[model samples]
Target: MAEKKTPPPNNNRQFAVWGLIILLMLIVFTVAQSGASRPAPGETFTFSDFRERVEASEVQSAKIDIPGGVVTGKLRNGEDYSVNVPPVSADPAGEILDGSGVPYEYAEKTEPSVLANILLSLLPLLIIIGLFFLVFRNMQGGGRGGAMSFGKSKAKLLTENTKRVTFEDVAGVESAKEDLKEVVEFLKDPSKFTRLGARIPTGALLVGPPGTGKTLLARAVAGEAGVPFFTISGSDFVEMFVGVGASRVREMFAEARKHAPCIIFIDEIDAVGRHRGVGTSGGHEEREQTLNQLLVEMDGFEGQEGVIIVAATNRPDVLDKALLRPGRFDRQIEVPYPDIQGREKILEVHMRGKPMAADIDVKYIARGTPGFSGADLANLVNEAALLSARRNKLKITMREFEDARDKVMMGAERRTLAMSDEEKAMTAYHEAGHAIVGLNMEGSLPIHKATIIPRGRALGMVQYLPERDQISQSRQEMIARMAMAMGGRAAEELHFGYDKVTSGASSDIEQVTRIATAMVTEWGLSDEIGPIAYKDTDQQSFHPGIGRGSAISPETAKLIESEIKRFVTEAHDKAREILTDKKDDWIALAEALLEYETLSGDEIKALLDDGTKPKRPDLSGGKRPTVSPVPTTKSSKGPKTIGGPSEA
Candidate 1:
């Protein structure tokens, strides 16, 4: 049996303290209000009536409160009455009362004590100061320490007893895991390397794109070594006050020294680790001071023998050079996007508890998702399970996974978007042109699917799904891709007359232009441009009065521009020639898209191979089922610009 723990009594004590403060304020207000002038316990009488009665000698006794301006007396009939009077020392009523020979006394005005007067004056100031103290105390996270702990490190310590995540929880980045395994060994037994006079790595930097499991790998190290883990973000060290960040760095390292064998994990170190003097504010900035302190703490005169620092950042290029040297960050581990087999393994890990259909193939899903990170795969599995639950299915099927992949890559289907007949026909022909050109081009990727249904910002799209992950592209492949991009505009101009062509091909023109420019400037595909790399100058480097501009001269710039234009013109001609030769096939495919709205790779191949029309499956009551688009390799979907000036 487990022992049940109760909340601490300090919470009740704090509440009681707050209640007492409120009660004291209320008592002060009540006492001040009680001292104010109040009506006497008697019928209010006019001053003239009281004077006439006093002159008749009907009043027996009376008392006058001078400050309160009220006169109270008892009549001969024993009735009590109060009369309003002026609060002046010399009045005719006083003389009349004295002449009537009625026994009366003047009530003396009472004065507050000296201490009470001082307290009443300072009450508002005290309350305001108390409120400020309470706000600062709450902002300091309620009694962790004092209100002015701005220089204290915000690092949270996680002991081994917390929820443990081993290497099994991490997948898809095997190389990064392997590189960190030695750090675990060092934490377990430092003698293995120390015997040979080899010091353990002071720090390891995990560099990768976002969502590549960098932070997860760090947690796995702590779990494997069964050591304490101190985690904080790079931004947590910085503060608005100068020297605060440096103080925090010193405090964090001092605390880390207490638990010598522990690991300090800094997530997103780029926030504080950027190059120092590059900013316009110069090196005296608070962030630079923090980074300087961090550099010294990692490799300064005093040794941090058993404490290992693990940092993760997506932007390694922005980090300071001194931080990446031999003693500071000894190992720079690259956690790149997973390949096909690694993605499959990642999928299997994510699908551990999911109720998957028996016949579902994980490899197929992995193949279709070429560039998906581990986090992406996890999201895909979650999305698939949600879709299955939505359809009231017991197990997650292949169809559900495919639909989730589509939704993850391309945006959800815009089923309610109503398009005019003319717009719909134009979209169909435009997408059909892309598919036709890609199918005919020798080195182009296989056409996966084509659809006129709007998904994301695209009014229509043709997806090019690569069979394998492409590490690099050849010259032919690049040319073929440009031709495919030009295909959409080429079809629009041919079907509608040149004058009637819409601005729907604006995205296509942009894609073609980008590819042509890259081919000329960076890829060295142009014969005149030669193999020399003419890339853009680094704009981030600071040089006073020197504007960051083009690296090449005007003459060379004009030559590059002409080469880009030549490549685009050739691609455009190639697309037009292909469309003219395969004119009947292109028209048939467009008509099929008009009827079905979408076509898969197999269905399209069958349609173009022979003259057979592709039939959409009638899944629900003789109505055709809507087929959504799939993921693509390059440019997922081309935008269909409408109501804009056409690009030349």
Candidate 2:
């Protein structure tokens, strides 16, 4: 179908407002200029001087304005003159003029036209009315509300020719797509389902984390079904006025019914669908009212056979129970972050129109990003293209992708950050400790890179790359991770005296504490706290006072805290032991980072294996060395200590 483009609303009303103001200003300016055009009396005289001049036969043809209490005339010498008449004796001025034998008559009193009087009286009221009309017209143009149409639905209609999206445009959530495909199929041909006694679902709720393509999926369903789509936000239905939201809900459903087999998509329904009476101040009456109307419209008394409602929200746990019942939202589809294969598909979709190098491996990029959503992958591709453009490259390559991923994950590198020799050395040693521990510790993830370049909040970083996405971590792996996290602090205390250690290990200490606490309390790793999950007191409760207190008794709480401290202490000691044994290798890696500022996994591995530094590869030519798959091993060094500890 040919797309019809509607012209935008003209701002003629705004121009009219300006024109009215200009006209009023022009009228005032013309009246002031006309008043200034009248001749000024050349000379002023007191009442006595006027009377003397008149009696001396000096006044000639004097004219008196009785209402204004002033007289003007030409003197005998032809000079213009004027005199004031006393308010108490207006008749005296006329008598004096008569006695002077001057040919003078009272100035004729002029009355204004009746039409002018009416127009002057009505001008302000007309300006006020025009202003109100213009303001209301502007409000109506927003399409959300107006002075009189406050209860109208703000849903935007999307036709086939407008913002069309099909299933082919979406990737990475095949299950969600499959579920919605049934809805589309029913809309396409209702007879297929009606004959089999299977009634189509009234609504489906897309539940997921943010940026998982929930809204896009809804649009795709409408496109595939070739039906009209009405898109609105849950917040649009709410207003400060009572009963306004209910009215809007009724109007929206009524409109949807007119176009049968249409889809109505509400984004972020949690904004209005929150559990009633759970707020700090009882509950939001406006939002609760909106949700009530929506619930009724979904499975109301009136038969809405063909209209389908699809809403997206990340916060399904907080939604009202009535909204998720069987009849209202028949399907609750989960749109989670893409797995490895799904991520590759998402990457491919985002990379369609971009110029990519021959060596750009989509699978490799996907593998590196474990918990990335579809939107994240799209951003990654765009960032890579931007990086390539910055370098004046024709196509995005693996190097640009790698740089973009690092920039996204860690943050852009801070090349201009200056550090003193002492600080730089400490940062080098700190990151070196992390790399060495992560590489040699049993069950730890493989170290991808170690760099002393400042990025984000970290002065240096040693990043680990998982071979695959991990669903669960064993106790041994958790212990290894804790030990690795403590390595930086251990190295700092072992090299510099305990008093000289910097706060650079704060993040490492935090990570170690979190891992140890989770292991003991949540994961039930400690035998003393066996197989029990203790609820965290910090968790928020819907009720005012309930669930706010600690679930565990004081004795159990102290025991848990002691166990957490024990786990961290053991991990720290183990890291110190390993660093003491591998002092030479650790020193060599730290010195290498200081010289080169960055080292890849292979370079770090080779440098640790021997004392020799490997030659850096040139990445500017857009060709990168092939990456070998990491061996799936617990540890490669056979648990051997590298060197003897130096004498204190």
- Whole-model Cα lDDT per candidate? 0.80, 0.78
66: Cα error in model 2, Å: 5.1
Off by over 4 Å in 2: 1-108, 112-145, 279-283, 537-551, 616-648
Write one digit per residue (lDDT tens) for candidate 1, span 13-39: 456558857866875986677587787
What is candidate 1's TM-score against the reference?
0.85
- Candidate 2 lDDT over 1-648, as tens digits, reads 113344554556556778887876665565445344244477989899988888898888788876567788899898998887754544787898777678888877655567556656677887798778867756554453344566888788787886678999899999999999999999999999999999888899999999999999998998999888888898888776667788899999999989888999999999889998764322377788788898898988877889999999999989989999988887999999998999999999999988999999988898888888888899999999999999999999999999998888777888887555566667677778877777778888877778887777677887777888888889988888878878888877777667656677666676677777777767778988898766464662112223225655567777877888899999999899899999999888877777778889889988888766867643224332221221222111110111101000
Candidate 1 clash pair list = none
Poorly placed runs, candidate 1 (over 4 Å) = 1-31, 42-44, 55-58, 73-81, 91-94, 121-146, 160-162, 279-284, 539-555, 615-648
